[model samples]
Target: MQDITDVAKRLVQHNKGKITEVYFVACGGSLVDMYVSDYFIRSESTTITSGWYTANEFVHATPKRLGKNSVVIACSHGGNTPETVEAARIAKAAGAQTVGLTYNDKADLLAVSDYSFLYEWGDETRVHNNPMAIMLELTVGMVNELEGYDHYNTFMEGMKLIDTIVASAEKQVEPRAKAFADAYKDEEMFYVMASGASYGHAYGFSICSLMEMQWLDATAVHTGEFFHGPLEITDENTPFILAMGLGRTRELDERVLKFLKRYAKKIEVVDAKELGLDMIDDSVSEYFNPVLFYSVLSKYRYALSKVHNHDLDVRRYMGKVEY
Candidate 1:
């Protein structure tokens, strides 16, 4: 967590002069890209653009957009995907400097790019992409060429909270997770509500485990949007995990908890405080919570992967998509 934080801060510092913009590209799991884009916009004087496509769309329609002044960070968990590699190759061909994000030093996302940073995690667990997602967000700050931020100790202090939460949750959430997973484990679908920092949490949880592990269409939603109209989709039978947060918006925390209790099938609170997760309440900037949450909250994914008897790495067997 701290390492990635430093990477982000460093990127911002290093690229301060040559570029005035940044781009995040991904195919399917592009939530991480969005998080980084938000960070760049908030912290620097650069235009942050996020674009997504299936590998083929990117290859056929957008791959030519890269250039020397462009610093492209392309991501894939396995690094072996045909499209990510193809995309990176295209970027290189078009004279764009590229970096690959992955967990494996030898994967294609790394192989095709000029430099790659493998996230410091070893599990494929339930959500193999957690590390990648969080790392991308953490590293984004560095890529933006911004200066004067002290994030290393700050981010780890936040991650410490996550570590604390999981250590306690290892004992506390099992029954809850098992009960929820078993009850909806066989069900066809569910929903996830994520607001603020937890949006990244919900994004990873829904896509990697709730949807991928169970083969359900778990969703990530913003609470404001939920109240607008999507709230109609909530029901007594729809299992939900509300990604409660203790970030900049305490109001969101209150609203999410209240709504989940009344409408969600089985409401789970990721009370960043009560879980006994080691967290630094004061030092963290909320935009970076995904780094901490995944480092700690992600244990649940590993636990579920074990419960389902799946391999440690989901992508080892589950290829990106079918032809």
Candidate 2:
């Protein structure tokens, strides 16, 4: 695997003073991973503008600003997601610096992208090599080189602990996850909510894990948008999974949690604060909490799969029939 930071530094050196905007494009779970990077860049970079787009939409309605001075980071875990590959191709055609992240070195995304980084998946010891971590490394590295990020060193320090952090979180949350699966095994629908960077966790878990994998209906609700309309759906019998992160937007999640605690009976709160998030520096901890949250959620997802006798890989419509 190529060193993501070195690739990012090289990109910064090549594009020096010209890079102004970045677009993260992908679909489904990959898109959710990009959302975390998009959020990180927006929060940390002062000079760079960022956008997150679904791969197909990006290919069709390409941004006018996506040109030589822009960077587009596209991800597809298997490296063959058609829309993502096309998005990378389109971005390159628009003269944008394209970087592709995937677990496959032979992935088509690598062919279209200027730089390709192979990330590790399903490896407990190499958790830092995951897509989200790779993307964050690229973002942090680029930002540090382009415009001196204050917490660059701290972020690097935090990355060193990622594997341990993730492993500890998985162990800590295992019992809770089993209990959750057993309790919600027969539930037909669920609402997953979170704020800040952790929102991606909720979105991915709700859609990919619960809905697609388990054949259950699930909706992801942003805690910040809860009271606007989603709150009305809350009732004593409604099942909800709330992810609370140690980020700036945690209060937003807490506010929603308070309401859920009162009105909702079946609610599971996955708080990163309790999941070894504090092991990292506070400045960069929020960005890393999503990884911890995902680790915890994966255990729950697996447990649920067992309880429902539904294998996570078994899908009804996806890849079974042509769309």
Candidate 3:
């Protein structure tokens, strides 16, 4: 596999000053994975605009600005998601530079994209090579090349610790994860909450882990938007899972935690600060919080699958039925 940074460098070099916008398009968990990149580019890049879109919607309502000056990063784990493939094709047709990330070398998404990256999966020691990490590297690489990020080396240093961080966090959260699964096995629904970079973790856990895998109803609520509407659903018996991050927006998660502690009896928090987020420099710690949060919370989902007697791989309609 080509080095992700090298891939990013080539892409940025090819476009240089001509690139003005980036669009991230995917579906399901892949779409959720794009959240961090979308957030990072918007926060770091002054010259570039970014958008995150569900693949199907992106196809139906292609952006007017998606032309020669645009770069579209599309992902599919297996590289065969129809909408994502179509989205990549459309972006290519519109003269936008397309980048595809997938775990499969033979993925259809690679055909339409100008650059292709194969991210590592199912390997604990190679956690740094996961899809999200690859996207982060690509984003940071682009920003560093375009506008010069002072903390670029810090970000690179943090990547080396990803495997250790994920392993340590998984070990630390194991007991809590087992306890949570035992306690919540009978629960019918859950509300997951987080803010900033960690929000994508919440969204993926809610939809992919709980709803799709366990057949339980789940909703992901943004901590910043909780009081506006979602807080009304909270009560002593309501089950809630909160992912807290150590980022600039940590205050938003703190506020939600305070409220949840006050009124919600069933609350579980996966805090990045508690899971060794300090191992990375403060300047770039927030960008890595999602990785820590996702790794630890995955333990909970595994335990839940066991206690609920629902195999995580079991699905009713996905891939087996037409929508």
Candidate 4:
């Protein structure tokens, strides 16, 4: 990961004035992993804009801004995702500096990238800390360098504290996660909602975990958009999983929570403020809550799979054949 920071710095330094924005491209979990980075870059810098796309769509629509002066970031778990690897190739062909973040150093995506970051770890490390953290670190560090924000240095100094926070969060969330899975393991449908910083978590968990992993029907809606249409689908028995972030948008989630309490019997709220993340400084907690939300809700997924006796890795179509 140290190499990743250097790669990020060099990417920024080399593209300095030429680059006006960065495009993060991937698919599924990888795409979701970049949401926080996209949000961070947009929120933290005025000089640059951040955009994201699934690699397939990125290849088909090819943004005009993705050119010689742009930076393209592609992420994949194994780094061999065909669409992502091809997207990296296209970006490079366009004279954009490409960075690939993956778990495997030898991934095909790396071969096309100008720079790549690989986190080599044993099995336990996979669950201990997600690749999402690495993506966050790399993106945040790069933006910090570009904007001259010293938060990067502070974050480096706090890695140990961050690890402690993750461990503690796991312990704090496991029981609740099990309870949630045990209760909802048989439920055929669910509605997940959130806004602000944690909206990505709600969206990703609903898509990647509930719909994709468990093959369940789930809907993810931004709290602000809930009343727009989704509200009509709720009733006394509807189940909801609300991801409440500890940011300015808390009020948005709170409004939905208030409404749900009156209408839904099975409403599970995963509030970042209530989670045991006090060790993380308040100064950065708001910024870090998205990744923390991943750590907390991921446990729910583990429990969900367990109670249903379904292996999380089971897939009927993903890797079995060409799409």
Candidate 3 C-alpha lDDT tens digits along 1-323: 67777877777778655778999999998988888888898888888899999999999999999998888999999999999999999999999999999989999999998988888787444777788888888888988887888899999999998788888888999999999999989999999999988888899999998999999999999999999999998899999999989879999999989998999899998888888888999999999988787778779999999998889999989999988
Cα shift from native, residue 280, model 4 (Å): 2.6
Which ranges in model 1 have alpha carbons more than 4 Å from their true place?
1-16, 27-57, 61-66, 123-130, 133-145, 150-153, 156-171, 263-265, 276-278, 283-285, 292-322
Clashes of 1: 17
lDDT tens digits, residue span 160-228, model 2: 998888887888888989999999888999999999998888899988988888999999999999999
Q: What local distance difference test score does each model get? A: 0.57, 0.89, 0.89, 0.80
**Better model by lDDT, 1 or 2?**
2
- TM-score per candidate, in order? 0.74, 0.98, 0.97, 0.93
Q: Best candidate, lDDT-wise?
A: 3
Worst window of 10 by summed lDDT in candidate 3: 120-129
Better of 3 and 4 by TM-score: 3
In model 3, the clashing pairs are none
TM-score of 4: 0.93
Tens-place lDDT per residue, model 4, 39-109, is: 87877777778888999999999998888888899999899998999999999999999988888867899
Per-residue lDDT of 174-195 in model 1, one digit per residue for the tens? Answer: 5766655455545566666666
Least accurate 10 contiguous residues by lDDT in model 2: 119-128
Q: Using lDDT as the measure, what is the rank order of every candidate, best first?
A: 3, 2, 4, 1
